[model samples]
Target chain A: MNQIDIGKWSQRDLNMLRTSSDTREIDLLTTSVRDLNATLQAFGSNTRSDEASFRVLTPNGAHAIAVGIDAPLNVEIAGHVGYYCGGMNKCASIIIDGNAGQGVGENMMSGVIHVKGDASQCAGATAHGGLLLIEGNASARCGISMKGIDIVVKGGIGHLSGFMGQTGRLVAFGDAGEALGDSIYEARIYVRGKVESLGADCIEKELRDEHRAELFALLKQADEAHKADVSEFRRYGSARKLYNFHIDNAGAY
Target chain B: MCGIAGLFIKRTRLQPRLGELLASMTSTLCSRGPDSAGFALYTAGEPGRAKLTLTSVEERADFEALGEMLSRAVSAPVSVVGRYTHAVVTVPADLVNLCRNWLLENAQDVRILSEGGHLEIYKEVGYPDDIARSFGIASLGGTHGIAHTRMATESAVTATGAHPFSTGPDQCLVHNGSLSNHASVRRELGRDGIVPQTENDTEVAAGYLTRELKRGRSLGEALKSSVEDLDGFFTFVVGTKNGFGVLRDPIACKPAVMAETDDYVAFASEYRSLTPLPGIKSAKLFEPKPATPYFWEH
Candidate 1:
């Protein structure tokens, strides 16, 4: 892996990583580090090059994709990660600055992860824990999961999403797509946006003042735009039937 | 690490409930610096004299002793201003420095937050309301005043690290921003014989601006001088016995919002932080022109 060309990494970091190639990974991520995978291939790590790693790039221009290095690593893609990147952030943090790709923070998780950017889906399709932060908009099927992974989309999530979520939290700052949490298991879906419709036993509950306060508090910390009066949004979650796999709730999504 | 809020009553009609108004503002800023909070307020009766409120005094060993020491130096009757772990002392028109020195030297780490006309200084380690109530600022009354709350970042979240620092007579300043060029400015101020008593960047700002204001410069001119002298981003909400001024640095690294109604005006880090009103009007937001000196007339 050390012999492979890491040139395919983002242009933002090409200059930085080009300057130093042998620093320890632990030191690189002390504050805000860039996740430039291709650059890692050139450095000779005492550990295997195939392992997960995260580094923050200076972000001079907009030209980097597939920012995640590999699995068993969580990369918090800090700034703006450009395009189809983070498609395979299995077991790592792939948080972005603002928005992210068609498939972000996708797949496996013995380790948890995050994506600060708005994902483009299919995000978190398989197992996971840790969390993801989409400070903006998510395009589609944010969490087509089958296992335990907490996917928090602080923005609006797209259609057919959480289609078969087995479990965990699916937080959305905005609306959920049609047939959300469909045939979904114990997964908890909290949305500040209006749902087009419910999938299966998924039901909408009134967002009380306390709930509004809670959501507002979260949005405030994330620096997301939220009206002081958060009564504008609704809440969605499991109807409990999904926990037992009732015949009526089967494929209800 | 401290959060300070002030209420400057424009119309004398709003004068009677000045203390209550200041208490509300201090309480609103509780989250910013929960450690301790205080209010330094002044009414028209006691003109030119600063009445400081030292709130939530967990330690009593130096409280009265410090107050007595300040009174002898200020040459004015520095009475025990309030209660609730807080004390209030008065600085005569010419003895502000002597009073400040006594407060600094006599106490372990004293924060002189807002020593304008009848300075009402209050502080605690966590929770602004607790400090305000403890100091009894909720009942103290005046037209112009300042307060502080803090989230410890650069300096220890102690009474000394609070805002509304005294720069001159009936003149004080509150700051929000990190001074990137603190070392350079400190050296410059030191060269001019102005000594800062704390490690906080704001103290350096207060010290530098205070020196300029003492040299017969107007508040506006002094702030302008600070703009030329200080480096890095900042938005300052300065208070005086007469009124308050809002100034910002060129970069505007931090967020500050100001809104004015026919009756009252408000300034805060976030737009929503201000008390929401009935109208759909938008706030007039301005980031200080980097390195430009700006201030408002009372």
Candidate 2:
């Protein structure tokens, strides 16, 4: 058996391996990002039943690290990443050990992206499906236009979070900045701490048993089931007042 | 979009590497603003001496004879250190105004970039890396620095329109967003005898801070009030003789990421610019909150 040192393997060498169950390590310092994404993208077309795991080292705040992955492969990024780290992700679990720049998991179809450190503005904007778990705080305008995605933030979220969401679930364990869920629709928000102010067309709603069950499941998925209680959280959703062209509510428009 | 980067050294041992670290940081932001680049560096100053940074297109014809003429006018030894298209003239602290007035009346070709005891500003219409290399920024030593790369939104891409705009002694400001009410604010400032050097909006903001500081307001107070007075989207990084400050507008659409360690506090438009710094992996990184003023002084 020939044991290949994964660290010494070049981009050409990595390209030769069609499918493998072994974990591959790709150092971004030595390998180009184009090659890394190309390899990950190739897994989407593979017919193999085995799963592949990849470990990316020294991300160094590079943009578009592992975008457009369509397989159930697990990818772990070691350091900080720039804009759109795991954008348009599908069926893959991407973990970022360090901070992430703007739009960490934008427009993902399915799967999970876990950011261990803080995330910049718009953490999970316009995503149709999947989960984005942020251990640290997320800055302004998180989940601006979501179709269907589950987001669990362990820390605080900045202003205008969950704005104009058509359908989704956003859970924040810490305090929320001003104007939470402005002009929102259908998407539910559960915040445990203080909400600075609710946005236009968004209002606090009673948390029922089903909502509690949903929140509990999300908290468990984020590994904070024991740290936070479902009953302690308050639910917010659209008031549905501005849904139509009402003459009385012209000021809101 | 524009890019802003700043570094304030907390540990005395790291002060000597300020320029080298800032140069690397600024180089990473070349894509954000490639039209022009500028930087302001603060060094230790003598008690009775002041420095004026000047730039001219005709460096040889304008700078060579101006130093001797200014020295004779001020009756003090004024030494000029000339680099590519820029020079720093040191004069007696009390005679700085006289020297400035003489230069304004006598030297029509030379333009003053900054005037202060410890501050020296260098800026040009070029790529950030090229500008940093031309000024030898990597070899210079300083206590703190602020740099800007401009994309030229509101004004022409001239050297004077480039950022790190200095309106007062030892004070400079770099902005990453556009101001909506600069024309009104410029007119308002004109009533108070505060005139901006360029049509650029960032310079108008710098002039506003200079007026505020001249009125006995601290840097923090000035920044806090700026959020209310300036109507625009902005992430401003301000540098003074002894401090550094960062502030964002209430509607902070522009991006700003800040990192702090035991040795220094750094701010950039994006996280990529900070990757070149030492011990950055262990640094406490966070985005500056909106409508808040954060300041650190020596």
Candidate 3:
């Protein structure tokens, strides 16, 4: 067990280590996930003024890589990851150089997760706060049940994206698949390409100047502002029809 | 939840490593399903010859002297190779139906796992790694293969309930999700003279595909129709004599990832299953879309 004893390090020593720009490389082929996560968790418990960069190699679709971090850190994973990569992340910037499996940033509290390749279903499902950027396509339920997260996809999104979204912003530069924003709440959706269909209680809304500003900010935060034009995007949100039960809408229920 | 792994070798040079690659692929999914595992391999066979994979609970009572009895009944040179509780029997292609009928009448205790020219199916109630090792799967050679690890969602944890259910000659199907309308579909197929051997829903799906192919529908057509007729969350990987097909339901909650390279095409319930394949680092990976059928033929 290559465990780090954070308790033994004095505050002065921790401050000195935090000020130094140290880059650590952890190879998944040689190190077990338990050790890697323990080391990262140790860093999470210790506050640092400078960003510590950790490069993880050969993830090979392993689940729960770099999850539950609570401090500022920069993680670069060189290969594909399985379920829940960077899940519950906070104050960290995690970049996946390859594709990611289901729920890439699920339930993340705050931070940024950038997936260079495609992502599987439920990319940012139920996330509360985070900026999830997918450079490639995202499969079904890209932001399903999202609360406060902001997701930006450079490519297309599959069906049922933002389904039952409570509060969030989902932006896609490419086409949106079937049933976009089905039964959505206060969440806002922006699509530059074709929307195959809208789901129950989800309808297109006016993209006012305020929305344009918000979209611009999100795009800039995702480092994709230059790739898309704000004028080309359209917005969708809840119609609030299914918010209450009624006899006329019993079939939908 | 269950796990499914499939490999189709496009390059002939890579055929010899099919079983080896598939073994490594399926082994990674042991955690997803730990109850039972099975695989169907499409190997090269001699012309005018067919093979049947048979299994019995009591191997000594059912498999011993089976070759001599089958040889006398078929009036041909029959070879039976027994491995653990399963046996592979080879006979003349023209005598396949006769052999099947003879076994049905005489060998009541033996169960047929597969019957085809090039396909051989093996399954048992155990871990995927144990099943693969016991069958010596890594040493076998084939052009394509599909494997499954079962968690026994809708059926008992018996060897017969395992996946890679074969219903047609040189055809097999593996499923990762449970089917809701299997009972009704079973009744419908029964009316067409296609009966499933077990109460397993996946076997019924395999029976449905067999019926469609018997009606002259292509593999792609059969899979496309399954999307409409079958009700439930499912991701199916089916293989024929020279083709491989994949299909997911409309509300595809089940996981399915696919990878393709210049050498081979692979499918799995998760990308982790494919990471062990050669050149997987550079393979084109993507999730199969919902309600869509993707097919490849050699």
Q: Candidate 3 lDDT, tens digit per residue, B201-243?
A: 9999999999999999988889999988999989999999999
Q: How many residue pairs clash in each candidate?
A: 65, 0, 0
Model 1 regions more than 4 Å off: A1-253, B1-6, B26-28, B35-38, B44-58, B61-78, B91-116, B276-294
Which ten contiguous residues of candidate 1 chain B have the minimum total lDDT? B278-287
Tens digit of lDDT per residue, candidate 3, span A33-116?
878887887775466636577999989999999999887777889989999999998767788999999999999977778899
lDDT of model 1, residue A70: 43
Predicted complex 3: DockQ: 0.71
Between candidates 1 and 2, the DockQ winner: 2
At residue B94, candidate 2 shows an lDDT of: 91
List TM-score (chain A only) for every prediction: 0.58, 0.89, 0.90
Task: Give me the chain B TM-score of candidate 3.
Answer: 0.98
Candidate 2, pairs of clashing residues: none
